[model samples]
Target: MILTFFDQFAIPHLLGFPLIIPAMLIPLTFFPTTNRLAQNRLSTLISYTSKTITKQLMLPLSQKAHKWTNPLFSLMLMLTMLNLFGLLPYTFTPTTQLSINMALALPMWLMTVLTGLRTQTTTSLGHMLPEGTPTPLIPMLIVIETISLFIRPLALGVRLTANLTAGHLLIQLISTATLTLFPMSYTLTALLGTVLILLTLLEIAVAMIQAYVFVLLLSLYLQENI
Candidate 1:
C-alpha cells in the first residue's frame, strides 16, 4: 500500500515510449518565442522578467563570470517551469528523479570546479587546506575538505529530490484522507479539504523556492571559482 503511493514518481511508459519526453516538452509551450519582437504583454513581461532575473543573479560574480548569466538563467527558468508544471493534474515532475537531478547537478558543479582550476589553479587547490594549519591537522583537513568538495553535487541533487518527493507524498496522503472521509463526515471532510488546499498552495511556493535556491547555490559556487 505504501509502495503504491510512491508509484506516482515512476516514469510512465506507453507502447514502449517514455512519457517523460512529452512531460519535459510541455513547459516549453508556456514560454514566448524569440523569433520576432514580442507583440503582446505576456511576451514582453517574460522578456523583461528574464532579463531582470539574469542581471540580479549575475550581480555577485566577477566580470569574467558574466559569461554564465544566460546558462544560469536558462537553468533557473527550466527548473521553475518543470516544478510548477508538476503541480498540475496528471502531470509528472522530471526534477523529482534522482538520476535527472544528479545529471543536472553534477555537470554544473564540475564546471565551476573546473573553471576554478583552469583559471586559478593555485587558489583552487589551496581551498583544500587552510593557510596556517598545524602540521598534524593538514592531512586530516585536506581529506575532510576533499570529501566535502565531492559531496556538493550529491547534496544539491538529494536536497531537491527529497523536498519534492516529501511534498508530493504529503499531498497525496491528505487528498486520500479527504476523499475517504467525504461520506463519513461532511464537516471533517470540509476541514481536511481546506487543509489540502492550503498545503497545495504551500507546495506551489516550495516548488518555486526550490528552483530559485538551486540556481542561487550554483551562482555562489561559480563566485568562488571566478
Candidate 2:
C-alpha cells in the first residue's frame, strides 16, 4: 500500500530498484509506429489527426513562425501521451513535477522572446511602455510589465503541474475510498466505482485539453513576438 498520497508521485520501486528509467522511456512509445509507404488504419488515423491538429495550430501563426509547427506539434503529442500514460494502473507522470514543466516552458519561452528581440528590437521594448502613458506612471507600468513578462514561464509550468497533480490526487482519493467502502456497502461502493469511471474519463479529456492548451499558449506567445 502507498504510505502517502504524495508517494505515488514519487519514482516507484520494485525489489529496491527504482523504475525511473522505464518511466522515462514510456514516452518513446508515444511516437508514430513507423514510416512506411503503405499504412494500416491506425497509422492512417494518426496521420490525419496530426495533420488536422497542426493545421489548426498553425492558422494564427505567420509564415515566419511556421517553423515552430513541428516543435509545438511534437510537444502536444508528447504531453498528451505522457498524461494519458499516467492514468494507467502503474505509471509515473513527469509533467506532474514543476521542474520538468519549467524545463520545457522556459526554453521555448526564451526562444520566442529572443526571436522577438532580435527581429523587432524597437517593437519588443515598446511593449514595455505603451505609446501613450503618463510620464509619472511610466516607471511603475514598466516594472509591472517586466514582472508580467518573467511570470509567463512560471505560470506555464505551474499550470500544467497543478492540473495533473490535482487530478491524480482526486483519482487516488476516490479509489481509496471506494476500496475502503467495499466491505461496508455494495451499493455505495458500486456508486463510487461509477463516479470513479466518470472521473477517469474527465481526466482523459483534461489530459488532451491541457496538452493542447500548453502548445496553444506557446503559439500565442510566439505570435506576439514574430
Candidate 3:
C-alpha cells in the first residue's frame, strides 16, 4: 500500500508541484487541432452533458469583458478535473498540496508584475499612494500596497492548499473511523461516506472559484497599474 506522509500538517512541498505541468496542459488538450482532440471532445461532452437544455434556454452575450475570463475559466476547469480525479478511493489530491498551489500562484503574481510594468502609465507608483497624505504616509502606503501585492500569491497558495488539504483529511478520517469503529452497523458509515463524497464534489467547485478569484484579482491589479 502507498503510504501518505501527512496525518495532518505535513509539509505540502515534497508532494512535488509536478501537478502544475499537468494542470497547464489539460486545457491545451482541448484544442481541436491537437493530437489530444479525443480528450478535448470528451471534456466538451462532460461539460455539456445537460443535453436536455436547448439553445432557447441559453442567455445572450452581455459584454466583451467576457473574453478576458476564458483563461481563468479554463484554469478552473482543469483544476476541478484534477480535484475530482483525486477523489477516487485511495488517491491523493494534489490540489491539497502547497507546493502545487505556490507553483501556480507565483507565476500569476509575476505575470501581474510584468504586465503592469510593460504597460507603464504616467501615473507612476507615486499615484497609487493615497492622496493628501504626508511624505511619511506616502512611504507607508507604498509599503502597504507592495506587501499586499505579494500577499496575493500567498493568499492564493494558502486558500487552495488549505481547503483541499482539510477537506481530504476530514473525509479520510471519517471514512477510516467508520470502517474501524462501526464495522458491523454500516448504515451510519454509509451515510457518512455519502456525505464525504458530496463534499468532494463541493471541493471541486471551490477549486474552480479559487482559480477565478486568482485571475480576476491579478487582472484588476494589472489594470490599475496600466
The candidate that achieves the highest TM-score relative to the unseen native structure: 1
Which lDDT value does model 2 have at 5? Answer: 90
- Against the reference, the lDDT scores of all candidates come to 0.91, 0.89, 0.60
lDDT (tens digit, per residue) of candidate 2 on 1-226: 5569999788778899877667767788656548752468888887799899999999988999999899999889888888888888867888898887899999999998999999998898898998899999999999999999999999999999999999999999999999999999999999999999999999999999999999999999998888
Least accurate 10 contiguous residues by lDDT in model 3: 52-61
Cα-lDDT of candidate 3:
0.60
Full candidate order by TM-score, most accurate first: 1, 2, 3
Predicted structure 1: lDDT: 0.91
Between candidates 1 and 3, the lDDT winner: 1
lDDT, candidate 3, 67-120, per-residue tens? 435554555555666666566654445667778778877886776576556656
C-alpha lDDT of residue 201 in model 2: 99
Model 1 — TM-score against the truth?
0.95
Q: Which pairs clash in the backbone of model 3?
A: none
What order do candidates take by lDDT, descending? 1, 2, 3
lDDT of 2 at 179: 97
Best by lDDT: 1
